[model samples]
Target: MKLTTKGRYAVTAMLDLALHHKGEPVSLAEISERQDISLSYLEQLFAKLRKAGLVVSMRGPGGGYQLCSDPKEIAIADIIAAVDEHVDATRCGGLGDCQDNRRCLTHDLWTDLSNQIRVFLSGITLADMTERADVRQTAARQVKRLEMVADSAR
Candidate 1:
């Protein structure tokens, strides 16, 4: 399945939050700054995430957002689903309408593929990703680049 930017960004932003999470919430603005996502887009995604009960918002000074449960409890599939992303690899969105509004010859194959992709994503959690040295290194490098860009912009 080809994940669109919305799904990709939601996962990336969630990972950023999980990685930086401490005793307090992680703001979307901070995530945007570090991950290079637009503040408005993050806001939209977080709204859906909050509704999905994947995250909780803290309202006050030093408030932003925090995972409603532990990182291990949050699956990558959950993140994608919370943002209304469908991982259908089928051309007809698994509706069997790929061939002139009828079932295509390979509709079942594509549907099975989409299901497998979902299963794979569901098996992965944000905490699992955080344990990867490469994930941390890439995030650090990205943040450093953002800092340099900000410095140059000033």
Candidate 2:
């Protein structure tokens, strides 16, 4: 499924906050600068996230935004849904409904794939993402080591 810029930026902004703030309040400027997203765009995305209770904002100097819940509790699906993102790989909302008597033969397959994608996204939390990052790093290191060994043998 293709994620729009809004959804991608929102997640990156949120992850920046989670990694840097560590439960402390961080200003929008910091997140924007670090994530390379425009301050104005962050403000817009954060408004939706705040209204959805995924994040909270504070006013005044040294005040900006903070997550309403632990990062571990937030899922990618939550952020996507908060941004009103749809993951329909196929346009047309997966063919017309059966009751409309125009159901596409592949409708069920698309529907099932959509459901699986949703479930997979919801099942993973931001904390799970962090773990995945660690796993990626480990794999990279292993690959580097193997490459070095191959170079030595050459």
Candidate 3:
């Protein structure tokens, strides 16, 4: 199933925090700038994440927000569920009673796919995303440096 912008932004926001983590809180504006997310939206999402215990907020000059636990310990599902109200992929409305709803021929398929999606998302963590992002950043930097050297040589 396709993920919405809310889910996508939540992941990016968490990754921003993971990248700038220095054993202290990071301001929402900092993460907003880094992720290119609106400060107001970040503030809204952060409130939900805080309530979910995925993040903690501080209030002061040096206060902002921080992950409640290590990135590795925080699953992608946690972030998505925190920011987005629902994560069900194949449900008609909610996850209550879809088995007995007549005319639902693909009900089993939807249910199975939902389970797979949950497993896949829960298997990944914020730390995994951060590590991959770091690798991509380093590779891009190297490519840029190589291109600059080639241009200078030419």
By lDDT, the best candidate is 1
Top of the candidates by TM-score: 1
Which stretches of candidate 3 lie above 4 Å from their native place? 94-103, 133-154
Q: Write the per-residue lDDT of candidate 2 for residues 1-154, one digit (tens) a residue.
A: 5779998898777766766565578898877755668999999999899989998888887898888888899998899888777777544576566445677777777788888988998998877765677744654565467668779999
Predicted candidate 1 versus true structure: per-residue lDDT over 45-120, tens digit per residue: 9999999999999998999999999999999999999999999999988778898899989899999999899999
Give the C-alpha miss distance for residue 133 in model 1, angstroms. 0.9
Ranking by lDDT: 1, 3, 2
What lDDT score is found at residue 65 in candidate 3? 96
The sequence of per-residue lDDT tens digits that candidate 3 reaches over residues 1-154 is: 5688888898888877887778999999877755668999999999999999999998989999999999999998888888864556565744545557653667667767777887888999978877796745954565467668779999
Quality of model 1 by C-alpha lDDT? 0.93
Candidate 2 structure lDDT: 0.78
lDDT of 1 at 102: 99
Model 1 lDDT, residue 19, Cα:
88
Whichever of 2 and 3 has more TM-score, that candidate is 3
What does the lDDT read for residue 27 in candidate 1?
Answer: 89
